[model samples]
Target: MEKCRFHEVKVSAPSKVILFGEHAVVYGMTAVAASLDLRTRMRIKPHKSRILVNFPDVGLKESWSPEQLKTLFQHKPNTEILDVNYVYLDLIHNFLKTESSDLRMASVICFLYLYSLIMDEVGIVPMEILVESEIPLGAGLGSSAALSVCLSAGLIGVLHQVQGYEKSIFEYTSSSIQKEVCGFAFLSEKILHGTPSGIDNSISTYGGMCRFEKGNLEPVRLERNLRILLINTNTFRNTKDLVERVGEKRVKYPDIVKPILESIHAISEQFLTSIQEYNQDLNEKKFYKILEDLMDTNQSLLTGLGVSHPTLDDVCRTLKKLGIVGKLTGAGGGGFALAVLPPSISGKTVLVAKDLLETKGYTCYQADIGVNGYVIEVVK
Candidate 1:
């Protein structure tokens, strides 16, 4: 338990969206996901005797002494097994009973767990962490995963300083560091969302587009970057609840639900293949058509899964009327819908679409798809 040489550490990780697959990916189906420019940033520095976290996005600002956190957990996490330590989490829940919001409490619990686990490598040292994020919370976007990845990388950056590593191994540029961050972030996500597909964290870690099946990630190469308009429904939904609902539906009618899942899986594969084969010089219009069609079918299947909300349908309809196709990007219910913006689309059309959506009480964000993932820097 030595002190770190660096004065502070900073890290950022991108949020992600399901480009083609959603709940279907959880069933060992191949799904496509990509990183969004939206990101969460975390900064960590030494404190006197308390570990503090200030996450203003959720209106959470809390502190706990090292001894206080230690007493709440049975032991440090086992790295080999990244599963949620229910015994420890239950203890944390009991300790944080005073916290009114479950979301905020879950964030604290995850911070405590990761803090203790990472601190085990360098002993408990008091620190203060502040997170500022561009990503919206509980919007099907990987805001939680981005937070987890950024927090983990920042903590690991501290470890790098303490261990006297000449170069920071926790930096996002390295593939190894990406894998490490993804693993820790996945565990943190499990604390937040009970049954995350691990797709969000994976895309957030490695960046670009990827094909995810079960827990495996295969990065996909894109000939040209895709543009998207992120439409926020401004309606919050519990991802765990929606996922569980789909699971229950499957259990009640496997014959009916299995086929939908299979169809969605096919759509994802087709989406991937279409993107890979796309050539702007040869047939640019055809590429957009293929992608738009896949999005339409995927949204339909998500509707059948009963996750799509009326507002989501409204979003799709609004975008489709403008010759732009869109679908719910995350767990449906009501989060964010992604609308593809073909290169040929005029800026005026995008503005018109945004103005129309805004009038309907929705927020829109313009960002490039498949952007870089996590990045870290140690401040001396």
Candidate 2:
């Protein structure tokens, strides 16, 4: 390999919350996703001979030699393929020395697949990558998508250096790099999840807020960023399974499920409009009323779809007693629920709610919504 030519690159991508429309989004309904303050960070720099990956959050620490990965690349499936090549994935599973399926294994596979393909474009360079995250894994907070976006941005940053570029690839207004990052991250999401709505990767890449429907994304603007209380139920879920279950329900009772999905879609549309109106008029009371009603209705619709868990319901019900309304985010089996704190809400009220929930064995995080998406810095 040629001599290392650039300093290390550090990248971070924020976690996401699906404010409205979870499972129904899979059926072409619109979903609203916003970036949370929580994020996954990665540091990547040149190494001597082997490629190293360390992700302590999920307890994944593995290294691969260039030659071994090169051998695996030789068996790569057809370039015309649209989905993951199961043969190649099986080979990766065998190489990883694990038969059980889990997020840790999924992380490793996503890393290897992305690293190999991206490196092949800019030429192989021995590198070491270490990932640390504040986002909880499998908590419906877009943890995996954040990791994928961080890695994609970090690797592409390296690619820029290898091509003799001097400036960072990510800027607030750069659309091409943003699209590339989203594209790579979306592919990684597909590998981990057989089918994903692509909202997670898109939100992690673009940041701020977006309205996603049927593979199309439109940016949503807020006059002021929203404050949210993220509640982790401590119950992990399989997003793919939850999505599949919803699919089965739709197939079994389209009449029943289709209307529910359409209602959720209407809720998302109304929620978007209400937020925009609030942005224009700054009517906290009116907006909160509409938001609360929408949240309650959306949760009921999700419950009808059989995606809401007991823990999720408990969280919402508890919040309701305190005059706060919340709903499940992401895939919605049992992961995280979010409460949009009104701008006029008192700190004492929030603390009281947090204390009450923490006492009941739930975790709570105070975070801002619609924060910056992916960011990159040069490591000196």
Clashing pairs in 2: none
Please write out the lDDT profile of model 2 over residues 7-70, one tens digit for every residue. 7999999998889978777878899989999999999988889889998876778888888888
Backbone clash pairs for candidate 1 read none
* TM-score per candidate: 0.87, 0.89
Query: What's the residue-level lDDT of 212 in candidate 1?
Result: 87
CA shift at 8, candidate 2, in angstroms? 1.1
- Runs of candidate 1 with Cα error greater than 4 angstroms are 66-74, 77-80, 94-101, 170-172, 236-260, 279-282, 304-307
Per-prediction count of colliding residue pairs?
0, 0
The numbered model that scores best in TM-score is 2
What's the true lDDT of residue 135 in model 1?
89
lDDT of 1 by residue, 1-380 (tens): 35544568878989988888889987999888899998898899888888898988888899888788767644665767878887777767778774424676677788888877876766777789999999887777788899888877888888777887765654436667767778889999888878876888888887899988978888898767789999999988887899999999999999999999999999999987787778335488898888888899999999999999999999999998898899998788998899989999999999999999999999999988888888877776
- Global local distance difference test of model 1: 0.84
Report model 1's TM-score to 2 decimal places: 0.87
Per-residue lDDT value at 291 in model 2: 90
lDDT of every predicted structure (CA atoms): 0.84, 0.85
Error of 2 at 329 (Å): 2.5
